[model samples]
Target: MDFTRLSSVLTVVGALMLPFAPASAATLTFEDLNSGQASYDVVPSPYKGFAFSGWFYGPDTVYAPASGSIDLFTDYADPTDPGAYVITSNNAITSAVEFVFDGAAFSGYSGVTFELWDAGNLVATSDSLPDSQGAAPYGPTFLASGYSGLVDKVVVSGVQGYFSMDDFTYHAPASNNVPEPGSLALVLFGLGIGGLSARRRR
Candidate 1:
């Protein structure tokens, strides 16, 4: 077998398999919390196999654009405000982050901001949007992260508490342990060629 040809085939096959690999991504729909609960002290809950903390999730979360049922939000009875909140993943989930800001009608909208983090290091931030589109059911602002996966946590702020969010989506990084079927076939073909070349030399 020609070693050079084998190396080349394996490299090519590996590259070709990436797009087919399953990224274990998931979304938090905030549908599990009881509708009557209202607090930021809830224990970490697991959703779609990922555990997350920070922020509050319930029916009080304003209006969800996608689920139209419940959402994750930061707000409470206004005797005192509940400041900025966070949504943290217990695992290193990466890539294709997305969410919706369910803002409501309010006079001085303080805008909404988010910070993506990996291992306590900041990764990316969405430009703070005051949603100047005017209030009275502050038109939901959809946000996506510029950075993908390895982001383990997110700090949500600047909405000043009484705000809503829904459909927190993210993807896990593609695994390197498995080969796609297409790539495996290509590898077998390359091996056959190598075998044939070796046999011809005899």
Candidate 2:
């Protein structure tokens, strides 16, 4: 057997398998929170997976969206004040970060703002709601993609905390120990054994 030709074939096979590698990703819908819960102080809460915190100087609560039965957290009691909610993942999110923000979910008139950040820098900022198209029964959903950076937390702020959000999705930040594609690993293993066999034959 020609070891040189075998090596080239394995190289081609490994390259072809790159796109099939496993991806790291996650999503949060806030649907697990109990309806009508009014504080972040609840221990062992539904948001345990996320380091969730609410930051509103006034009243805040989690309730279902208008015309929909999904739970959302907001401080809509005064649809005229400013408040925010922050959630941090156990690991950083490094790609295709996105979430659903329904500004009108609170009053169908007010808009909200969102900020993505890491431990030190701001990653991205979303526009005020009622998006360019005006408010609808369902608020606007924001999407941030293609950028390459690590974000561990997302802050949602609104004048009066009257906005709603759900379906938080993102690609989890990769770890240093992440493995290569299975096919590539197999190819490498085969190459290592073949190289040893050729050495013995010589």
Candidate 3:
């Protein structure tokens, strides 16, 4: 009947009833692609995390602005271009997409832009690609995260020339995996034992 003891018991009960949280976000780097799929030679048919409507996948060093062998490249050329690229994720709710890009990969290259859409509704967009003018052969890296709302598709577009995007990283919604029935039972049992012990001590 003690107020403090009752408060403690209620807190314990609330904690015990909390559901187990599990990771729900996933990332795709395209490293799983084989040699036949490198250098933008062929699109990764039915790639996981997101579906590709129009895009090129390759290890073209000329596009990726990072050091070492550019293993993968996501080219977002002119919207009018036949090979324009669009990515969509249907398996899970997408949250963010972070990738490296080189706006000046080729001549007439002005800048780049990207957009996030959920169920055909535009949710987020990168209006102007940052003008880093990367040094030497590589361009600058950019990380875009903390997107609001759920995203299902992403579209990358360039101004004049083609924009080279590499290391496409997409984030899915965070979810706490539900604990196994046995695990939950054990946890509940432990909490009950602790609660009984506390009551006896009082």
Candidate 4:
């Protein structure tokens, strides 16, 4: 075949492969934790496979010993006044609860999108937590992708002073394309022609 014809065929082949290359599918879900401090647990109902867990702390307070129960002192009290209601701990106070999941085991997803609702202001470890803090909720939302293997943990701190977490969730990509034998046969046929054309051009 002439070089011009060969180039035209190669361009067509490249166009065909474009759709199958890396594509981003962003999705999210939310699981509510009704007024409680608990370790991670699987989300119920529509989102059963995903799991989430976290704890709350007051200013200058240590986490409670119990796993799935809320501690009013550490979980509800205000970090500034101690006598008042503080959702997240003071910045000076470091320890906070962590929530994590095995992305591969649970949903076969590579990453997650996290959203937090704190009645008070929150200081996220990963991103700069939004500064505006009040009874009205405010937090950051972003994509987490590119995983070598299963994702073990995702930590969100500052549950004490003005920070609180209402809902945590995980999302899976929609398409799981595993080609059937017939589809593979078609691809192989195209590849064979492509190989012969490549050899002739050489």
lDDT tens digits by residue: candidate 3, 65-166: 433333333443443464553432221223234322212122123355566676678767654555336443335455453364556666655432244444
Q: List the residue pairs that clash in candidate 3.
A: 21-176, 22-175, 22-176, 22-177, 39-58, 39-59, 40-57, 40-58, 54-85
Q: Clashes in each model (backbone N, CA, C under 3 Å)?
A: 4, 1, 9, 12
Model 1 clashing residue pairs (backbone):
94-149, 94-150, 95-148, 95-149
For TM-score, the strongest prediction is 1
Score residue 90 of candidate 1 by CA lDDT: 26
Runs with alpha carbons beyond 4 Å of true place in candidate 4: 1-28, 31-47, 55-125, 130-149, 164-202
**What range of 10 consecutive residues in model 3 has the weakest lDDT sum?**
99-108
Q: Rank the candidates by lDDT, best first.
A: 1, 3, 2, 4
lDDT of each: 0.53, 0.46, 0.48, 0.35
Q: Candidate order by TM-score, highest to lowest?
A: 1, 3, 2, 4
Q: What TM-score would you give candidate 1 relative to the actual structure?
A: 0.56
Residue-wise C-alpha lDDT for candidate 1, range 1-202, written one tens digit per residue: 5687667767776786777667664666666665555544442445554444445555543443455556654544341244433222221323233322222222223456667776668877766656445545454556555555456566665443445666676655655466767877777797678767876886
Give per-residue CA lDDT, model 4, range 51-140, as digits (tens).
234333222123221222222121333335645433332212111322232111011001222223222333223333443345333322
Better of 3 and 4 by lDDT: 3
What is the clash tally of candidate 2? 1
Compose the digit string of candidate 2's lDDT tens values, residues 157-190: 5533445545555554444354567855886787
